[model samples]
Target: MEGHTGCTTKIVTLCTFKLSDAHVHYRTPLTSYFISHTSHLTSHWQSITLQNLYLIPHTSYPIPHTPYPIPHTSYFILHTSYFINNIYYL
Candidate 1:
């Protein structure tokens, strides 16, 4: 989050929602995410689907000379790890 907008303050927040509609085909037509940005320095809001959602405190990688090496992305990605049906997030 450094040098992105020339702001050193970290107010980034990652929000994720996992949705599963029980149907043989398309059953649910809903855009179930609320995202808004009042300012450029506001926290980051992202809407993504996940089979399993887990929160990690911090993540590290083998990148060099990176201000924020730890990714601020969602801890769980959609349809990758855990699999479940009829999962509704509220």
Candidate 2:
């Protein structure tokens, strides 16, 4: 999925792999900005809070955004759990 407000933007992606024991989850923001930080994926459900929800105007698959574009931004989403896997890209 994709969302855009104007020109500031970052690519957000999430992938989940079902394993025999648990899920192997992959996220773009986590791996892109924090390569040194890693966390184990689990089947357990998680909760998160999303703030400043906006109705983007752009109709791109990978949403583009703000007054100007900002590449490789990690602080795009207020909360990661706000979007499901493969549904939002900003």
Candidate 3:
């Protein structure tokens, strides 16, 4: 989709695969980036939205953006709802 002319989409997967640190060390850069950010195991879960939506370990606002290669085009508050406990984007 990177080179394709029109791919206005962000894929979200309900990932259930178990992970091992040893296994992740060899992942491709794109996947490794995602796994690294989400690998933080947390007991406390909450969602907050500013320019982007984030699922952090605490109930706070202004969550950090997932560091990845693609650049964000634009931002707006797109409303949020309760989720199953994972990072989300607005």
Which model scores highest in lDDT? 2
What is the C-alpha lDDT profile of model 1 across 1-90, one tens digit per residue?
A: 111221122223322331332111111234222111212212333354333222222244222333333343322222233544222221
For model 2, how does the per-residue alpha-carbon lDDT over 1-90 read when each residue is reduced to its tens digit?
Answer: 464333222321122312232222223544321110012222321232222222222222143322333333222322323432232343
Clash pairs detected, candidate 3? none
Model 2: residues with Cα > 4 Å off, grouped in runs:
1-46, 59-90
Superior by lDDT: candidate 1 or candidate 2 = 2
lDDT of 3 at 33: 22
The residue pairs in collision within model 2 are 6-65, 7-65, 7-66, 8-65, 8-66, 10-90
Quick one: RMSD of model 3?
A: 14.4
lDDT of 3: 0.26
Q: How would you encode candidate 3's per-residue C-alpha lDDT over 43-70 as one tens digit per residue?
A: 1212321111232232232325534322
Task: Give me the overall lDDT of model 1.
Answer: 0.26
Global CA lDDT computed for model 2: 0.27
Stretch of 10 with least lDDT, candidate 3: 43-52
lDDT for 52 in candidate 3 is 18
